[model samples]
Target: MLLPSRPAPVLALALLLPPLAAAAQTPMTATEFEAYATGKTLTYAQGGTIFGTEQYLPNRRVRWAFTAQECQEGHWYEADSQICFVYESESDPQCWAFWQEGGRLKARFAGDPDGTELTEVEQSKTPLACAGPDVGV
Candidate 1:
C-alpha cells in the first residue's frame, strides 16, 4: 500500500539564479518596498544568527536595533534604483538590494564584497522595543 505524505516538502530550489545569489532576480521598486515594509517589524537573520530588527513606519521612517547595541533612528530613500538608509549614528548610507521571495522579503548588501545576506525570518505588527536614546517610535 502506498502511504500518502503528511506535510508537503518545500524544495529549496532556485531557477536560473543570477550571479548575485539570494537576489530575487528582479529587485523590488521603492513603491513596492514601501508597501511591503510599512507597518511591520521585520526580523532578519544571517548565517543562522539573529542579526537585528527594524520596525518600518510611515514616511520611510525606520527604527533599527542591533542585538548587542542600542537602537538608532533612520530613514530610507530610493537612489539609483536601490534602497538606502541613513541613520543618526552614521553618515554613510547603508544600501541594500531587496526582493520578494516566497511572499517574504529578502535583502542583500549592495555594492559590497562581504556577500552579506539577510533573510526575513519573522515579522509582526508589534513595534520594536527601543531604549537608551532620543529616538522616536
Candidate 2:
C-alpha cells in the first residue's frame, strides 16, 4: 500500500490554526453590549498591557479612564453597526467595533484596520478614579 505524501509545513500550519480560529469572536450590537456591560467596571488590555477601564452605568452612561489619563464621562450609542462614544470633555465621537469572546469582550478602534485592539481583562466592583473636583462625579 502506498502512503499519501503531505507537505510538513502545510500539515503544521493546519494543526496550528484551530486555536486561532476559535479566538475569532462574533461582532456585537449596541443593545447586546449595553446589556452585558451595564453596572460593571470593565478593565481593558492591549498587547498584554492594561489599556484603560470603563464603568458602565444605566441609560448608556459610561466613565472611562485611561491608564495615565484623566477620567472622562461619556455615553455610547449605535450608529451604522458601530458603537460610537461621545465624552463630555470631547464632543467628537470615538467609535469601536466590539466582539464577544466567550465571557469576555474585545474591541478594535474604528476606521483603522491595523490600529489598536483591546480585550477585556478584568471586572471590578470599584469604579475608575480620577483627580480633581469632578473625580467621583
**Which runs of model 2 end up more than 4 angstroms from their true locations?**
1-24, 133-137
Residue lDDT tens for model 1, 6-107: 312212222233555654368889999999999999988765567788999999999998765677888999987778998887778888878888888777
lDDT for each residue of candidate 2 in 63-133, tens digit (9 for 90 to 100)? 98877677788888998777888888775788887888767887866654344467799998677776566
Among the numbered candidates, top TM-score falls to 1
Q: Assess every candidate by TM-score.
A: 0.79, 0.75
Error of 1 at 13 (Å): 15
Compute the lDDT of residue 121 as modeled in candidate 1: 89
lDDT score at residue 78, model 2, on the 0-100 scale: 91
Which lDDT value does model 1 have at 131? 70
Per-candidate local distance difference test: 0.74, 0.71
Cα deviation at 103, candidate 1, in Å, is 1.6
